[model samples]
Target: MSKLSTYVHVPMENRITVTLLCCASFVCIESLRKNWRPALTHLSNGLRIIESLPMSMLNKLRDTVSIYGSANNTEEELGMDYILRLFATWEVSCALFAENFKPVISVKLYRGRELDDKPLDEFESITQAHRAIVQYTRDIFALVWLFRDHQGDDQFWSQPIPRRQHEILSHRGDCMGGLFERFMAKPQAPPSGTGEHYSLQWLPPTVYPNLIASLGIEGRFKLWAEDPSAAPGRRFSASNRATTSKAAYEMRSAKYPYRSFSMKHNEETRHTYLALLASDGRLMVFENEQPENMSEYTPIDELSICTKPSRGEEVSFKVRFDPNPDPCYNAMQAGVANDSLALVVAGMAAVKIYRSRDVITTSYGVAQTQREFYLALEVGVHRGLVRDVAWAPGNIRGHDIIATACQDGFVRVFRIDTPHSSNEGKSWSTSELPRYENHQVQTCSRAGQLNDKQQHQSGLSASLAKSGSHAERHFSGQLGQVKHACKEIAKLDSHRTPVWRVGFDDDGQILASTGDDGKLVCYRQTPSGDWAKSSELAIVKTRMATP
Candidate 1:
């Protein structure tokens, strides 16, 4: 590395040769005790030299290597490959370890100089997955930085943590029995009482259809064939399911690509509804169960459900269904009907909840009924763009829990509490609203405004009322339409970078988040009703070299 640094002022051809040798040496010394500062310093200098080379010269070199080096596998080709690989590895590592550290070598700098493509293998698949994860983190970090610049402090999180029926999180670590038991092989012993013996054998791998290739991220939805336990060999088969169903074909070939999809099943009606978030900022909902011989179907636009759109033109991030069967009844039973369900959609700096509403109308002496979704609540306490949202599965606790990842460098956990279902007869009247001293008014609501008298009657102090006269705005088109109440119980800022994703354990006991910092953080509620960090795993800032 030191030799490479000294050669930075040498002739261009000599500098390239020396830098290549330095990179090869740096990658070979793959010891944990080795200092990376010198390697990074000299590598940056080497990349600068390469970046300054003329494109025509680089192209001519590439052509020469392609024509003659294919047969000999020359040492020069191998050295160049090592240098480029080291450059990519250090570039991604520096971006993940520090905040806002720009890469020294841009994509255009090495546009046609990347390493040669190799056949798919275990190592190749792992390398691709790692690159995808890094790209996702950088995208989320950029989004968060853009929003946080214009954002101010939020008083909604400043208030004391309110008490709720679901304040305590039950521990589920013991439910897994023992950690080692899961990985150990089972004994070949028969049951004491039952006289039946079962065979345990590995099933053959089943290959699926290939996905369509595209420039941007694209996904396809397909349903696999049912298990064939009684087949000749008792193995699953995809013999007749080589092609997707008609509905799946239409969805895959749609005009807009889908970012995410979710499904909800209704026990009473025995029907399932599929929700899709399009890349173009549209929400489409369709009934998953279709006729066997149906030749035509309704377009997704006509089947699109209602949503509380965001003020900005940002694309929708994620759409999720409340895992609870009756989220509406559990959270806002007082106002919503018994059969309604909750659906969550996250977008730019906001997460909104919609509830199913059935409307019946009679026109020209005919009666018709239609199911539509209406915005029930909107949680905009996040100071940055909302990246992901997760709804915890229903548990013994009476309230519903939601976790959101935001660009504001925090993973926020909120509990949906209703005075009606959680605690009978404990309702929040319109006249007794909580006071917000530092509440921001400009982004609160763009549709409605409250006068002095209304603000005063909302139980705000004189000073608070004066500062917040225009603070009570709704994202659902009009004010006073949303009656659902929710509170942010915990804000986990251990990531200290834009969080990309958040998820809850199966039992909703443990919440985990990950982001640009390359750290996995898990939170559990403490006895004092506050969320505390339970464990953290750091995955960034490490070098992996093959011997």
Candidate 2:
């Protein structure tokens, strides 16, 4: 306390003396000043500081509030708080209004037809019938084109002009005017000899209320009403009588059914279905319902069975398999031959071979023993686990080479050597070796398979040793070192997951691969002499539900 009092007293005395001196000095300075320049300069500096104070304080306040405030809060309680609250409420109300409102409109189709005659209740049915008619007309047009191109016949074309003109006139009358005059036309008697009669006729496009239009004699026909309660028995009889009158008309009603649809040709034991490209370059519709007769081959130019409309049909290419039967999954590999013969690898223990020239027939070439010409290897061990097989593009030493990729992350190439001498009884022999030319092995990592501590410790060492041993044994031996003239030309790591299927283009320039990832990767050999993935195409992913 004593030291603090002494220091405070000295400072107070010094402050008083300094204050008196500063006052005298200020008075002297004022007396000596001829003008007010120094005082004005000091005033200007003070004004500048005052001007900057508000901005500095505002920035500090902003930083302090930001540090303490909730980020989600939109409004601050300084000036204009009420206005901000009002704006926020308005924004919320606008959002609510937008959420609750929905826009809708009734879409109608308007052509040169009367509103009163349009079928309002049977709108859906009328639309479907109209679509079917359009398709049928297009098909007829295509057939006409094909007939002209292939047959070079002008008679079929020249004969139908008058009929087409009559049809066009009828369409104009029905469409432009509300005319039910043709509806009142007299009914003609059924044709002679047959209890029921049918005739092919065309109807003018018109909007008939609750009615389906059918062809009639001299601008006359019956209206099949859309009412379910309106005589179902009559409807069936009328439809049948219309279809059965002529052989061409009856055949037009024959239905073609398929169990499934695929872009490529698919087959089972008794039936085969192919997707035929129509002459007009459109994909014809495939019927999934089973056809009535399996024995009859339906050409791609048949008519509809239910509607009796002429439409393109589908055909099957048949191949026969001989002797005993063996069921195999994903075994057939298509080859380079223009004929659609698929090389089938089958059998449970020892893989047997068969070739199907066509898919429909069960008769095929007899099974060939695989062990006769090649090294005696267990089918299940070496080739039995073969998941995908491919045929090389070019002939290797006058023999075709086949490559098989297995489930155990290995690929092997085999050459099909047909015996040169006619004295040799066997049809074919094989020479196989591991495909190692310019190929790299992607070994499974130890971390991937190790489950226990002991396994983890020994995994790396064991894998390394096994890899080394295999390399020395296979690559160092004389047979292994000898590279066949027909070694694997290219090897690629096509997928991260397992590759399920492989396909080659007609020219063998592009390779397409599919895998568990549900992606189709196309590879092309580049100018740099490396197989590089060119593009990836999207595929529909199929998921199998667990039982």
Candidate 3:
């Protein structure tokens, strides 16, 4: 062969080898990718199947049902309750009250402990055992009973089975009978001295006949049906009204010798009736008559009452009031202001200010225009209280400042001012400054014009300056403390009980508090503006103690 021909042939062979290698690599890559998907999919499916099986099934097959019914009803009348009790009782007697109930398969116990292998023999005959079981079941399933009896043994299974068969048989009938009996009996003794007790029987629904009757008559009342398939029925009048009306009552006994009670009217009732039971058991009824003009009276949806004990079985009344138009007002802190505005913290969203005034009459002059106002604010916190409110210096600018404390331990400041800033510059206009628009200003400066020079002259200037200058100002020149919004700004930690009430002074310098533990704590603002325990005042001790 010639040298040129040999070189040319070698190049051709190299190209063919490179092409073959590429094809083999491509085939291997495709094969691997093809197998990957099925493997991943199979793994995912197996995990899902495993997760779907419940742990309960893995252990044992025990079923539990909760029954509810009237305590007042007889077995026949409480049809379902009666049947469940009967079934449980019958199962227990049949299973446990036998000559060979728990067939002995030898087991060992600790030396100090002793085992009683005595068989139950309470029933005279199988028929009697069945009857006892039925009676017992009726007592436990207090409301109603629902079950399927597959075996025809209901008629004759009461008879004791042959001893030889006991070993091979599943013995479900006997097992069920025994279980029902145990449940019907008192719960295994709870750890000694716990004093906790629970009964299988339930309270009677009939106890609230008045409530049911009210719901039936009032078309608005409806029951909360858990099952959509069940009939949509009207709940007893009381239950429906209780859910929708927003009217409620809470009664607390006044110490050992006194009693106290409070009632709240529902928002639905434009007119409300409140009955206060005093310590001596004397009832005082206050009827808030509906106004001729609905706009004049603020609709009261939620109500609460608080009472304080006085001398000799008489309680001085302190009512925590709320006029809820929305569910937000369901929880509120209430206080009376100088016999005028009834200050209330309604939910976390707003404060409700209510006032009642009498009108003079000429001859048969009928009183008119009992005004009610609701000042809503976005800054309100849930379970927050309008602990204390004060009019700004002079009340000249038609402005009022309010301080609120919340369960979360945050204190919020809200300013109620005339809607028009133009009116603010003018001297206090007594023209009954039309209801002020409640604005939740970011700072006091945004709320109104601040005298910077005067602020600088006074010690208060430092606090106002930290809020920034005019260029950053968004609203009126009012300045607000951002840190004051924290729930713990005015915390009361001295008492172990939850702080129920909180209040702040005009400068936001001092905080007053009361709580379930019946202790009053005073906290003062530190130089840094954080609240600290007041060194000047000793804690005011309350005479009463919580139970």
Q: Arrange candidates by lDDT, highest first: which order?
A: 1, 3, 2
Task: State in Å the error of residue 538, model 1.
Answer: 4.5
For candidate 2, give the lDDT: 0.30
Residue-level lDDT for 124 in candidate 2? 24
| TM-score list, all predictions | 0.49, 0.22, 0.25
Instruction: Give the Cα-based TM-score of candidate 1 against the true structure.
Output: 0.49
lDDT by residue for model 2 (1-547), tens: 2344345545653333333233333434553463344433332332232233334322222121222234443323232223222222322333333332111100001112112232212212323333333322332332332243535455643666534533553454344222222222313322222222122222112311122323232222232333344486433122323223210111121232221111112222222222221212222222222321112233321111111224543221111111112111111111111112223231111222222221110113211110001111112334323455554453322444444444433434444432223442222222111112211111122222323322232433433433342122221222111111223445555566545555455444566777666778787756754456899988664544546
Candidate 1 residues 141-172, lDDT tens each? 33334334434545532433311101210111
* lDDT (0 to 1) per candidate: 0.51, 0.30, 0.31
Q: Candidate 1 lDDT (Cα, whole model)?
A: 0.51
Cα deviation at 402, candidate 2, in Å, is 3.8
- Model 2 segments beyond 4 Å from truth? 1-342, 346-352, 355-384, 390-398, 401-405, 409-415, 419-492, 523-547
Q: Residue 496, candidate 1: how far off, in angstroms?
A: 1.9
